[model samples]
Target: MNKLFAFFLAMLLPVVLFAQTPKMGEFTQNEIDLKEISYEPGASAVFLVASGESRFFSNILETNYFYRIKILTEAGKEYADIPIGYFAGSTNVEVVSAIKAQITTYTNGVPEVTTLGKESIFQVDLGNGYKEFRISFPNAQVGSILEFSFKKADKNIEFLDGWSFQRSVPVLFSNYQITMIPQLEYKMIGQGENFYHRSEKSEGNGVYSWTLRDLYSLKGEPYMKNYQDYVDKVEFQLSRYQTAATTSGPEWTDHLNTWEKLGDELIEYYSVRGFYRTNPLEREVLSLDLSKGSQKDKAEIAYYYIRDNFINEGEDLIYTKQTLPQLLKSKKGAPGELMLAYMGILKSQGIECNPVLIGSKGHGRSDIVPFPFLNQFDEILLLVKLDGNLQFLDLSDPLAPFGYVDLDKHVKGGLFLEKNASKLIPIDIRHNSNKLVFSNIKLDTETGDLVIENTIRNYFYEGLASAHLVEILEKNDKPLEELFSEKYDALEIRNVKVDDLLEDKNMYNISFESVLKNAMSEDLIIFNPLQISKFATNPFTQEFRVFPVDFEYAFNETYTANLVIPEGYELDDYPTNESITIPGSPIGFSYSTENLGEIFKITARLEVKNPLIPSSSYGDLKFFMESVSSKLTAPVILKRISIP
Candidate 1:
């Protein structure tokens, strides 16, 4: 029996040592094994194994990530090259190893491996305090295996590390292990509803691990905001710290324990008081005669002065390198810096104003959490107390008026940093956010054509949308009239007149004259009076939505078409009207027509009373948009009673 056991031990000793060997930062042969992978159905590539290990040693924390992917189809070739980004200020990322192997039937299914050298790796410096390390695997093709490992080390103890198990492609197995020294305390914030498989006991040693398997690819839908908001991920924030000699470390201050604390920290960081150290725009503010008018009126003059003179460069929540003097002279600054300048100018005029930090529409809403973090907010606006009433100003938006805050800036809540104390306050702006379009059409029996005059009035958010649309058209070098004609081939715009296009006002009006060709056919005249319909098809095409559909603000759009029927033609049939209303949701769509003798009137209204619709009511919103689309497609058929 002893001789038989000795023989088995000798055979397995080599395999056990190789498996248990410490390859913490190396790409091993097993990782690049190109054996057949039972990939998930419809998956272009599969992550055979993905693991991340984070260890805190001495003063620096190092995170090593390893990934092995098997390419199954042509679409998976994109996975052969990947870019990894890290904050350049604190972290240094290094590619430890990368290897690629291809298995073929040649020589009885032998595998040929190729190691990626340092020449295949490139480091790119992306402005805005970030850098990316791009790595490409050589000789990677279908049925090939690619494996790479990278390590990022940082001495900063901010505890901002986050891990995401899901990606654009399916992951077969993902495991993350974190080991920390008992000195650091962190708050684990998790998103998504997936639970990780973890060990029973590891808290005593300051070690934790999570494993996830068979995670499907994250599907993107229309109108979706930042993908990070919905991805299944876990993040850690350093709340406080402890040490061996002292119970709590000196660097572990409760600076962000409350919203007020967070506000105070930001005020100190941005030097809010320093912004008003000098009154650079005093001459301009004095010439406006703001003292005689109400505070609201005074704010309008100041808002327009900033909006017209300077251009916002789209950066948010941070100050620009240029000073106020430089910014005012150059007429250009980032959005946050512009708002800060506005506040400084307003404060010099004895106006009560404070800065408010909130997330913008494109940035998505802040997470509902107890603690306060600067990353939670994106944009900065001002809060003005006028005549004992609170007013918000989004001076960054050129078209937005003083009283009319940009709907995107209304993040429901903001940290209002006041003089003595700070608090979390709700942002509510009183402005009409609607759009009205009235079209009058007259059919010419002699020319077989129709002349339609469209009058469009946009208010608040609606005006912003109109301004953005025109800006995009101009940026792309496309004429507004030409784009309109292209969108509807039958319609040709003759003239267009716009109002308040160059002003900061609540409403803007546009009127245009267009002609529709072939309105009068040989025997029948077919025309779609609602030719200016914005929606051709439902925007919500996803079968299931896991995230809420955020419209940012409530808006109402009304379209009225007054058509004069051509002589000797009677209406054979009109499109059936549609009215859809969900009991709980605030979205509504209605279509109706009224026959007023010679002038046949058709009115369609799409009113969204609620700015946001939860995923639970996605079906209702989809159905409403679908109904409007169908009604817009069906034309009004006219039959000729007698040929003149």
Candidate 2:
């Protein structure tokens, strides 16, 4: 009798453990009765349970995912329509079988479940070798609990997807489990692991698991580069694998186990190293007259020659899809190919340069983990050593200056791909005067209108961006006044003129006139001194920030306004001269006003010598920005004198 009872208890133990794990089409009373998460009081939705498991079956890697969410508000209903995306162009991974989803609601303590039909699942082709399978829960409402599950199969173990514990909504419980086989070795990289509630490893069965509870949602801040970089997540990379060679056993092979090994692999790749050896544009490069300028000047000439001749296909890819010959013949190629061709030309002219791999801003932080993961990078830029100075150039944009790198690609550092010396190097971002505005303001005595003449100068990256905008407007046959009108909505812009557009200079000038109607009343005239204020509003409005603020580059914005008082009006009130600075930082703002009998001169200078502000300094930075905004938008009041 004792033996029989023990056998029955063992059989029931497996069922109890399986029931503890969240399953599809099942909900507890507590989950159904939940109205809102206590920790996240303002959250629209909450993830009740999010779990995933991955294991190898018959040498094939398969992963299963399950998510249960509780909708607490009208906005939470948007989560009912879930879209799962996968790379359909590759033979590596695929969505297995159909997705299962259900919506559960309770009425008067009685539960009702509505299942999603197979025919309701929609497939959307998201171009560029990607597709999404979308599923919507039936009868979803504010109090509905939406649950969905799906499975994926991967033929190649190298493409293992990482797990994110946090999402845009609060998560109550999250778990991830993985079972590893003895034939392969994987290195685990984790971020925010300190937040984990349970981390267990069963070495006997090669099973690893991590769990987190009551995690707040991740929200974007003003100057955050990418929220994904700060999320709590874990990823696995295949470090070593076993291959069948002999009848005795499988042989172990190292795969990207170190940064040096990864560097060597990238050098041997056909699209990178082969392109340099071939030098398809050698003939075209020799025809140019590069003999007149210095080495730096000659490098700039070659940069423009390639930029103007070859059209960019507008794709940000690290590896080129076509050979150098194919690209040169077609006269157009991806940005990587064009940059490589530019490198070849520079090398022929005895210029020193190397290709640098960077993960763009949208691609997340390049150096988040210590592991040298190749997938982390997506863009390549040319780093040239000229005149004893290093210059980073993004040849993708024709309007970009010789030493200009796009703000999105301005990473802290990147992998400098030099032959046998490939390693990470610090990127010294060059600083240039970004914007300067000078405005002359006067009141039209007869019409009671404010007349303003403004001259705006943009330099470096700012100049390149403005040039691109002007080119686009010209291509569309739009008036330049539209730019100012959109910016200064309270004024009417006219006689707009742009200078130095598409020229060799790294700056452009814009001059325009504006008229503000009814700016003056019978007794008083009120006007804002700065017509082209840099800060329309304080950008740091959030109470707290989780990520550092990246302003991309250091810049100086100087605004000078000369106001000529009306004939019979006298200054009653004006903005006071003030200065503010953040302690221990190179950020400061100053506003000064000079009251000369008839002319009022106002000058405001905002200097941000350090572009990146750490999250710890967000409060001081926010206050500083708020002060600047208040000073720039302060009103200057004038009164009309009555002769007794």
Candidate 3:
């Protein structure tokens, strides 16, 4: 009987060890109960244990990372699904271990477990550059606890995205550990919360760890920067390396310590493969009646030559290996290559133009640290100095206006890569943007019906965004008429005319007509004079504010309406003219009504004078918007005149 028992114990030991949870604690049936985590209010799911560790192999020069997550949440099951992306080259990363996931549930005081099969996993090929591994938890349900683990091996040290402790969901216990060899030196940078509960340093073993508990979920806010920028996370930047007695690596400070050094490095990096050295196609381009134009005119000519001739590939990179001659011959190149060629052309013509690097809006701000970090910048433009003024140009977009960049690319500051030295420059959008809306309302004296005709014009950056919205609507097979009807159900719309779809213009115009309902009564006629007000409700609805408001750019929206009074009706009451401005903020709104005997005039203007609003001004901003919304939805009451 003793010998038989020993044999069974040996077989089951391996199974029991493999099923153990992460270092936070051992998994139990009690963890599957939803009531265990009911204290977390407004959380979709609660992470029971979130732990990960990375191991670096010095002999093989590779890093292996393993992570495990145990979660319990029937309400927010979306967190149970995971996606891991890997590059598709020979020198890229790959998943070396199989994923293990299972769901545990308790019923009638009995615990039941269901393991996921290989069929639940899927791989997607992302076209030459990358691929994705996706897995879905099996039997995922409320009151079910899920546990999953996976491992990834990567040879490229640059692919280390680091670890994030705070996520969109609340975490009960979070921990991270990393063990590295003596050859690699890393600069550690952290964001969000500063304090950690546990910090352990290895004893001559090159291991580091951090632990935190009961982290709150990151709330979603409107008009804020990228989500990744606000998460509590730790990242590593490989600053140097050593082998035996030799040391060699990137001198982060020497290369990017100052604005001048950063600019010089950028110019040198982009000028590789003799790009922008000499433009063989410059003579041919200049010969087309553009050789004799002024400096500004010639610059425009060169820009169109590149914009119309080359097809823009939307890859975001600082440098390209494709030579200028090859790009010219093929008439196809990435955005970087095309912009490089444009710079080369401008240089060939003796025009003064420098490359300006900026961070895209969705990519977050570029002001993280003064260190030389190339990953912060994702787009490049040209800063042309003509007649003692700077003109910004973006040739990557074929449909972009002549002297303006994309709305998202109009960042506040950028690094200017000058030939001799580099410097930081500020960009403003108020110089090239404007929005105007006009409405003409005619009231039928006999029928008490309102016919509204509206004309809207958007220029420059505002125009680009408006055009994109129209394009998306058309692409999704959604008509503007249908959308307008859905938004204003009390109106019947017709004669929707939009112009400048095929032409290249600095601005776009949209005109439409709508007949409003509930404007007629036996003794009273009531209607809203501002028919084209865009903001029907305030978007800043959160009770507590933490993040700064980033509008991306300063903008002005103006509405002017001309309402004709019916012969038998007289104005009983109207919205009072009022103007309000925050004490020190750049936000302001004004509404005015004029009682012309036959025609009533109404004007409303909302102006965001600055692109950024600090959190200190949140209360005033919210109150101002609330007042604007209330006034916009108020009705203008009119009473029938008795026979005199």
Question: 1-644 in candidate 1: lDDT tens per residue?
Answer: 13332333233222111011123223345444544334436567777677777776445566777777778778888888878887765334322233322222113345666666667778788877688878887766777767777777665546446578776767767777777555556787666535333312244356666767767666666665644555566677777553223456333333235676677777775563355533435564334455668777777787887787778785676545766556666777888888877777677667888888886665623454446676667778888887777778776666565565656676667778864587777777655678888999887777877788899888867776777777788789877785367546767787776676434556778788788776676576666767666765578876666566776677888999988877788889898777887767588888999999998899999888876677678887787778778787678777888876
User: What lDDT score is found at residue 503 in candidate 2?
Assistant: 47
Of the candidates shown, which would achieve the greatest lDDT relative to the real structure? 2
Q: Is candidate 1 or candidate 2 better by lDDT?
A: 2
**Model 1 accuracy (lDDT, Cα):** 0.67
lDDT of candidates 1 onward, in order: 0.67, 0.75, 0.66
**Cα lDDT tens digits for candidate 2, 22-109:** 6776677788789988876768999999898877654456677899999999999899888898876655346565578888887887
The clash count of every prediction, one per candidate, is 0, 0, 0
lDDT winner between candidates 1 and 3: 1
lDDT of 3 by residue, 38-89 (tens): 4455566777777777765422222333343444445677866878777756
**lDDT for model 2:** 0.75
RMSD of each: 8.8, 7.0, 8.7
Q: Model 1, which residues run further than 4 Å from truth?
A: 1-49, 88-113, 122-131, 193-205, 209-220, 244-258, 269-273, 277-291, 322-331, 362-365, 471-478, 501-505, 542-546, 616-620
Question: What's the ranking of the predictions by lDDT, best on top?
Answer: 2, 1, 3
